[model samples]
Target: MKIAVASGKGGAGKTSIAASLVLAKRGVLAMDLDVEEPNLGILLGCSPGELRPVHQPVAYVEPDLCSGCGRCAQACAYGAIAWFGSGLPVVNESLCHGCGVCPLVCPTGAMREREKVIGEIRSGFVDGAPFLEGRLEVGGVSTVRLIEATIQAGESLHADDWIMDAPPGASCPVSAVLREADAAILVVEPTPFGLSDVAGVLEVVADMKKPAGIVANKTGMGDLSLDDLCRRFSVEVFARYPFTRSAAKAGARGVCPYRSEETWVWKTESLWRAIERRFS
Candidate 1:
């Protein structure tokens, strides 16, 4: 069973909850699909391993074989190719979506597709448990592709239980990971801003028809309640963590909040079991 720990916005305690769930049991495969800003490994105290490059196809022009037909530029829907109508067309690597349309429209075969390194996957271990994380390269635009690659790599591990730390928001990157999960745990603060953020994600979860529960983090810090939103989505609240000075201090010091306090550990374990009983 795969459980995806996600949030609609950043700084909502998603990674902390994800780490707690992974620590709930031994040998549970933990994957960080937040390629742009992956911090699950740091929280898990994971030891770094081999770095595997993740590739994506991007359009490139060969000046030697050039025919300035401008057809390649015209055919590119994303305007990745720029033609002066006299010389070789300049292919912008960043704008290229790798749709393979540019190469097809090239009459002189000057346009070609080349693999570009968009991100790297790091495989490691957290207390002997397998951990995989995807880190997107700077100026990378293929976040969805990287996320998909990360999920594929994790699937190869063949672990019975898995916890995926997904990126924030209901965007394509988050959907890419959540689409493969068996269930999801949405961590949210009990505040007005937090409510709005989670509402967007809830719509996505509802649209995907995925079973999801809520974990209200920093409950005492906010006066607003998530009960109405939960009722609207028919998502039950599985756990709650009150705001505490120690918890905040521990997180700032790169410590797992659940492990820092005894009560928090019990709360996390109970939440895990409840999730297992419902989804497994």
Candidate 2:
């Protein structure tokens, strides 16, 4: 089973809770699918061992090929191929979805696929448990593709269970990760903004028909509550973490407070049990 720990927005202690969940359970593979801002390694204090580049096929037009039928340009669903009615059609690498349609549509076989480095996947261990992470190259437009690659790489571990720290929000990247997960743990702050943000995520979870529970973080820092939102979504609040100076300090230092605080460890364990009961 893969449990995805995600949020509607960033900085709601999602990564912190994910790291704690890994620590609370044994034999669970830890995977960080947040390619854009991957910091689960920092929080877990695990440095990656091998960095392997992830490549994707991008359409390349060969100028030497005779026919400029413009069919490749017109056949592109993503508008990645631009034909100026001149020498050669321009293939926008960023806009290309790597669908390989251009080559199929090309009458002259001018279009071909070339591998492009979109991101890198790294493997490591956190306390003897396998950990995997993906980091997208700067200016790379393949967020969902990289996430898919990361998930594929994680299968090498072949662990009994997995916990993924997904990117915040209900974007394609998050959806890709959630599609591979058995359930989701939505971490949210008890604030108006948090409630509003998580509402979108709940809708996505509901649409995907995935079981999800809310982990309210920074409780007492906000006046608003998640009661109405949870009731509307029919998602239970599995756990709540209080706002404390020490937790804040430990997080700032790239340490999960659950490692030091007894209360935090108990709370995390309780959360894990609740999840197990609901999904087991």
Candidate 3:
């Protein structure tokens, strides 16, 4: 089962929880879908292996075979093909969604698909467990596409357990990861800021119709009641973990605290059992 660990805001310990889940379940496929800032691999204590470029078909015209029929321009509803009075259309590569419609309507077969590198996927291992991550190229626009590719690459490994570290916030990238997940583990701090942010994330998770439970982080601190929010959303309280100086320092050094912290390991195991109950 692929479980997504996400939050509406940053610094809510989502990635830590995901990493902990990986420790609890050995030989799992751990994926970091946060293409822009992929740090879970760091926390996993593994560097990504050789990078594999992910390509998508972008429409380009072959000038030699061009008829300038204008059908290619007409087929593009995204205005990716900019038409000049009587000359061949210029393709705005950034604006192209790679729909390949231009090729379908080209009369002279001038339109062709060229593979453009949108991002890179890396397959690696953390403590003998499969670890996968995706990193979008600089100035890339296909965020969700890359995220989908990362998830698909992880699935290709065919692991029985999967832990997905999702990017924070309720953006398309987050949706892309959470929508396909078997369940979601939402981590929220008890601060006012975290509470406000988590409210929006809960709506997104609910809309997806995915079973979710809240992991209350920094349980002893903050005034905002995460329990109230969980009750409001009718979500189960998966785990409530207290703050510890060791956990914070270990995380700062790119170490997986769950590996050494017995309390953390137990909490994560309990969290896993609670979440798995929902699946059954």
The root-mean-square deviation over C-alpha atoms between each candidate and the true structure, in angstroms, is 1.6, 1.7, 3.0
Tens-digit lDDT track for model 3 on 61-112?
A: 8999997778888779888898875678889887777987888888888899
When summed lDDT is taken over every stretch of 10 residues in candidate 1, the lowest stretch is 41-50
Report the candidate with higher lDDT, 2 versus 3: 2
Assess the local accuracy of residue 176 in candidate 1 as a C-alpha lDDT between 0 and 100: 89
Candidate 1 shows a clash count of 0
Superior by TM-score: candidate 1 or candidate 3: 1
For each candidate, give its TM-score against the true structure.
0.94, 0.93, 0.84
204 Cα displacement, candidate 3 (Å): 2.3
Assess each prediction's global lDDT (C-alpha) against the native: 0.89, 0.90, 0.86
Position 274, candidate 2: lDDT: 86
Summarize candidate 1's per-residue lDDT along 124-185 as a digit string, tens digits. Answer: 99879899999999988888998898889988999999999999998888888889998999
Q: Model 2 over residues 1-280: C-alpha lDDT tens digits? A: 8899999899999999999999888778999999999999998999999999999999998889948778888999989888888668899998887988989978887899999999899999988999999999888878899999899988877887999999999889899999999999999998888989988888999999999999999988875777898889988989998888899899999998888777789899899988998877
Please state the error at residue 65 of candidate 1 in Å: 3.7
How high a TM-score does candidate 2 get?
0.93
Better lDDT candidate (1, 3):
1
The clash count of every prediction, one per candidate, is 0, 0, 0
Candidate 3 off by > 4 Å: 61-92, 101-112, 260-262
